[model samples]
Target: MTDTHEKRITQNASALDLAMRLRQMISAYQVSQAIHVAAALGVPDLLQDGAKPCDHLARVTGADEDGLYRLLRALAGVEIFTEVAPRTFALTPLAALLRSDVDGSLHALAVLNGQDWFWRPWGRLADGVRTGSSVFEPIFGVHFFEYLQQNPAARGVFQKALAGASSRAAVADMYDFSASRRVADIGGGHGALIAAILGKYPQVHGILLERAAVLEGARRYLESAGVLDRCDLVESDFFESISAEADTYILSQVLHDWNDEAAHRILSNCRKAMASDGKILVVERVLPESGVQKGPLMDLNILVLMGGRERTQKEYEVLLARAGFRTTRVLEMGEAWSLIEGVPAE
Candidate 1:
């Protein structure tokens, strides 16, 4: 072939690669939607007893048989469900978690992200990145928390989503809280972490500091968890007030929600409230070095959602050191998150 012909062939190959990539990028939403729809329709639960004919399943779900068949095929394509034979679908391990009644259900997350609240803001992600602010406010015409307050249905769904995400991880019970007797969880919405610790250590008591409205939900969760008797729920703003007394304080995924100046204000409040020998537990994802793929996909969210970030170990250390705390240790959790221990300096 002539040199011109060879160049054309190479260029065509590259074009094909680009075309394939673009298609995949565009279809990514569809793939997750399929999974979300399958969960919403309770398709996996339908197959729990045994595999059934597609028509029978569709009738039970009040969906079109043909449409259900296509959804099952798409889910199977993504390894969420498997078609044992034509028109017969069986549950795969991945699909089992989609069952709403299951203890480990991801149904809440599926509902939240698949619905308009999260999806709409995500659509404006580019605008957020460009402006260095949340498009959530622009897209919804109010802040996220305030939106939840006004929209009760959205609020319930959001709480369920938060609980669903919280359920998958190691809780405060899994940590060593022996160093401190009294603990405070600042902005600890729902109080799940503090409740987990109180349950584990009878001697340890905790206070959950959060907004007034969220404290209602947190109280419900704490009471249901059977830890309300031991844990105190204090409604306050971290920008204005943090609990003024605690032997140890915990802030999980908190600081990243704001810029450096806001983070300093929050940490400075915690510092003011701490005992002279208090320790701060900063539970957050420690961003890995270049080329490391991480969990929860929240780092990208930091860009689009809240303008926060996942920090490196070095960044946390420096941030704490500047705030009059010594970064003592970082304990790796099973997930991308880590427990960063900071103590007030002498």
Candidate 2:
């Protein structure tokens, strides 16, 4: 009944709340795995019409009925699904985005992240941080890209997941390409970004430079986007050299896959092949000085899986300066992406 006792009780309650919140954060991976299981089993797609009994879902997905019901109830607790009836579940707004047929579906993204091959490396993140090296090769016995090259199914899933992001068009709109005669997308996976650029600026020709393994998919994608004729697909490695010269170059989500030295090398290669008056558009996530951004977590994911780091704005400026380019400006493309524009230094 005293003021002191009341204050002490409030403080204790706050401490307990903090503890409870931290506990949820620590165990968030269980939710991710549950979503992955539901997506992998096409549960969202099955629920597209309406709510379905848990037993029916289990029968169709070939899952144990009791296990499926538990999974649904847990997800319902998180509001991903709704328990409309005793044993029936339906899609929540969040769950609808997991349906594969949707325009901006995250089905592939969910499936890819939960894959054992991709998930295992994240478990050894401590080793990666301690040694400042990629943990993927040690666990998989090969580089991530090489593993993708060898595993067709995984590569397909990865590419699909990347394509599902829907940022390429937004990236194209972030900058003006009307003045550019030719734009080359270096290390462009499946040429999606370039296709978006070509689609946006019909006057601007596009040249897609990537590894030989990627050109086929790039060709198919560009053709599907109706930009194949306007875009030239070249098979080459950016680390070694850029075979084509263009007035504008785009490095979309590419640099964050390598360490500073390697990223610098790729930039230098672009510098060499680019026209004297050309500009390079480095499309990537910019880590903020202070705040909660996906950039930091993605940076760690890159460090563990690809040995790369997400950089602050100043870091990108310094990195550009080292590669014989000067930072001109950075434009916001959308959430999760930024357009860092640089020109050859005088």
Candidate 3:
């Protein structure tokens, strides 16, 4: 071939590769939905025994055979499952995470993504960006938490999803709970972090402060974890008041659901309730100064769904200061979260 023709062909190949990459990015949501559907259908749980042919899986899952086969085939290409034979599939390591019984399961997260209450606002991302506000209330006709209060099923899915996404075990170990006699987990959903802390420190008692609707789930979870006796479940609004006399206050992944003004109110309430020598731990994903990270994505998610945003260390310091507490130190917990410790400013 001529030199000029060879150069043109190479350039064409590169352009084609670029196009394919862009196309994949454009259609990435399809893959996410497919994974959600598979999880919703209990595909991973079904495959736990062994590999199953598409027909059997479809019959068990109540999915159309041919359509399910195509779905599995596409997912196999993405390495979620392996196509070991024609129309037969087995779970990959990634697919194993969708099992509800697993220790670190993503099953609930997947189901949440597919749920109407969670996914609808994502459809209005452009509107949220334009208005600099959450689309959740507009889309659902009520505030996110209010909607959850009314819809028990959605609340269950959301709480389970939160449980799946938490680094509670890690956050529980980041500080010395031995010094704390009473740890109040303000707005703590289902009592995961507090349960972890109480489980670790047998001498420490806990107070889980959450809405009345959520206290039952928290009670059940704390009970199952065998820490129910050590915990006092309080059904109250954190913005209005927090339980008094707690030496340690935990705001686990809670503040990020509200804007600055609301977050400050919650913190101020905690400050009012806390003992003079008490410490407050804000466990959240702290945004880094530069470069790309999941923090930005989570920040956008907060904006789109809840009108909140992740903040940097300086922002946290300022916020804490505004609430009459000063950030003493930041403990780096892996996986994009950090424990921002604060003490009363006095």
Candidate 4:
């Protein structure tokens, strides 16, 4: 072949590669939603004890047998489930965790993110990217939180998902509550972290702040987690007000759900309520410096859904500085999580 022709062919091939990647990236959402559907149908749970053939599993799940077979095979291809024999699938370690009855389950998140309301907002992702507004209002005729407040079942799923996302017990794995006398868990839903801290630190007391409707689960979960002895639930927006008289304040995976202005408002509230020498611990997946941090995906997810984005360490430092706090140190935890400590700036 002529040199000019070879160069043209290589350019055309690269163009094809880029186009194919774009197509696959877009269509990947279907694979995710399919997994959600399977999780909802309890497919992994059914295959827990042993493998099952397509027809039997199909009958149980009320899915088309032939179609179901293809789905199981696809999931197996991804190491989510394993097809030990033709038309028969068994649960893989990854898929087994999706079981609804599992102690730490992501089943609620799977369902919620794949449902109609959430799905619609995601469909408008490009719009959100361009406009810097929540697509939820335009698509659903109301704000995402407002919709969640009105729907009890959806609210349960959302709150449960948030609670379930973090498997660590705050007292057991996260904080040295023994050193803390009082904590303000700002935007602390389901009271998981507060409960853990209060339960572990005999001398520590806590105030859990969140929206009124969302506090139902926090109240109940805290009581169940057995930290009710030293903690009180406050029903209010964290941006509007925060609990006073706390030595430390916490914002966990919460800041990523808002724009800088909104986040500053919340942090400033925490600052106002924080004692003069008090500290604040904001827990989040601090975006990495080198590459595509998991924070970006979550940041993007929030961008599309909640009009928010996650921040890198520098970004967090800037935001905290603006909110009258100084970023002190960051401690890395499991799978893209970090506990960032900040102090009231002089």
Candidate 4: tens digits of C-alpha lDDT, residues 97-171: 888888777777787777787777777889988998778888877777888889988888787777776734542
**What overall lDDT, based on C-alpha atoms, would model 4 receive against the true structure?**
0.81
Candidate 1, residues 1-346: lDDT per residue as tens digits? Answer: 9999999999999999999999988899998788878877888888888788999998999999999999999889878888998989988888888888887788778877787777777788778768877777877788777888788788778777766655224656457887668888888778768877888788988898988878888999999999899888897899886864789898887887776777888888888888888899898777776676664367667756666776788888888887789988888875667788898877
Clashing pairs in 1: none
lDDT preference between candidates 1 and 3, better one: 3
Which candidate number maximizes lDDT?
3
Q: Candidate 3: where is the Cα deviation over 4 Å?
A: 1-11
**Which stretches in model 1 have alpha-carbon errors above 4 Å?**
1-22, 101-104, 166-168, 295-297
Q: How much is 209 displaced in model 3, in angstroms? A: 0.4
Give the least accurate 10-residue stretch of model 3, judged by summed lDDT.
Answer: 163-172
lDDT of 3 by residue, 190-295 (tens): 9888899999999999999899999999999999999999999988988788865688998989888999999999999998887789899998889998887667
Lowest summed lDDT window (length 10), candidate 2: 165-174
Tens digits of per-residue lDDT, candidate 2, 97-168, equal: 999999789999999989998889989999998999999999999998889989878988888887776666
**Local distance difference test, candidate 3:** 0.90
lDDT against true structure, model 2: 0.89
